[model samples]
Target: MIEPPRFFSAADASIAVSHLFVRPDMLITLGFYKRKPGLSREQFSQHWREVRGPLIASNPILSKYLTRYVQHHCVPSNGWPNVGDLEYDGFSESWFDSLEARKEMHALPYFQSEMIADEHRFLDMKATRILMFDNQVVQVGRDYSAEIAAGKA
Candidate 1:
């Protein structure tokens, strides 16, 4: 018999959203920058909370369609310098306006050039779009058997 794949133990978080703005033929990308060594977690958290956090926070396009979920230890193999588990939630016709706005925002010199330049401290970086499915999709449930004097799956 085969066993289930082991999950990662260091998932930063997961942002699931419809790729409504990017062109149908163009791939919707998720950019992740690696954290440079000697960077403390607190410092890392603070930078996002104080700087980048506001940018993304203020973006009506992202706020409206993006859903951020906490994922602890979800990418064990993706070390500190790696960006793990980038995802796309497919497309939705209703998000066309938001998508257009996002494209325009990305085209901005401040975002495209400056921000891109500022994020080069990380170790590993990667990006991908959904052509097939992704990492395991697991569902949680109560282990009724444990309580009933039996067991589980």
Candidate 2:
């Protein structure tokens, strides 16, 4: 079994409960980004979290299709194994009802012209990678298992 992380703040635990269940057909993508050469990590993270996040959320076309969005900023870890030397500055996750919804969202002219253009402001486009997945929530707090199993999660 995969052990849960040893530490979580009260706020984090609450958020964890909200995501205890996963939609098997949900289209989820993890977008890893490298900071632009001249930008510091803080600068890149701020722009993504403050500017880009609000921009995407405010866009009518883009917001309608998104089910969930999260930004994960990377922090240095001590004593961690390093293999390839490749490191991502941060990652953003976006979810949709299906893969087709993602395709349709991108097919919009505004997404191609505005969204892609905005990304270039802080991301090293050449170093970015996007991985898609169907999410599965394997475990949650012990008290919530019955609720989740009852389809109320």
Candidate 3:
């Protein structure tokens, strides 16, 4: 009898996401003019262009902190690439002395002002799911075949 080496499952690589709201400005800027039918690639590109800068700017301080504390967040990349059904949502986090820090961010006028639903309107998407990620690993490969072969992923 032969035994096969145990490998981690795909779930092991998955991360949790929470409260993902598309920024309103991103909707129009993304040229996602239609609220019905199907989502288009043109719309996706526009959304990224409009939303990325503000999203990055809002967390400059947090980005620095996350780079220091989190391994995955520290990777230097202007944008993330997609693989099949999976999308790399990028990485970021905040370091706080207490929950008060979080509350302060939420209570900020700017944070409160942006509406996620309005942004998702173009896609006609009424619902969004948030997942929470605990443990995660970074995997990279020129091709899918290499990634499957290396358990390191």
Candidate 4:
């Protein structure tokens, strides 16, 4: 049996809101991936949270184009009924205005060199996958479908 209470750790608090001003132009990108071979989850998450995330944010290329950037540090989703192993170790979520702006960042030498080099340290690029899309938020809160059905909106 899984003992979640014994091992569970929580993330720090965060706040988020969606504004219509950014809705039309903002593009959201998700990079799903696994850690490099031989690295522990602690090692991966520390380097990513402490080193890699800061590195990306500090760069002029990314900083200018990116409005928000977030890293997801995966924890074992044990204790959920019928759950299987997680497919990837963690993922990155980034928000920017346009693909053209993103492409401009990608074209920079700093991105091609420094950023890619840093990612090599802890990410398994071969196993990485990307998803790019815009949000069409029906809701962004705890599920309240039952309440909504009863006209709580």
TM-score of each: 0.35, 0.74, 0.35, 0.74
lDDT of each structure? 0.37, 0.75, 0.35, 0.73
The positional error of residue 138 in candidate 2, measured at the CA in angstroms, is 1.8
TM-score of 1: 0.35
Model 1, 86-135: lDDT tens per residue?
A: 33211111121233444565577667664455444322224211121122
| Candidate achieving higher TM-score, 2 or 3 | 2
What is candidate 4's lDDT per residue for 8-120, written digit by digit as tens?
12232122443223355567677887999999999989999988988887776678988888898888878787888668889888887776767787888888988889889
Q: Return the lDDT, model 3, position 113.
A: 59
Q: What is the lDDT of residue 105 in candidate 1?
A: 58
Error of 1 at 79 (Å): 18
Provide the lDDT at 64 for model 4: 92
Task: Give lDDT for model 3.
Answer: 0.35
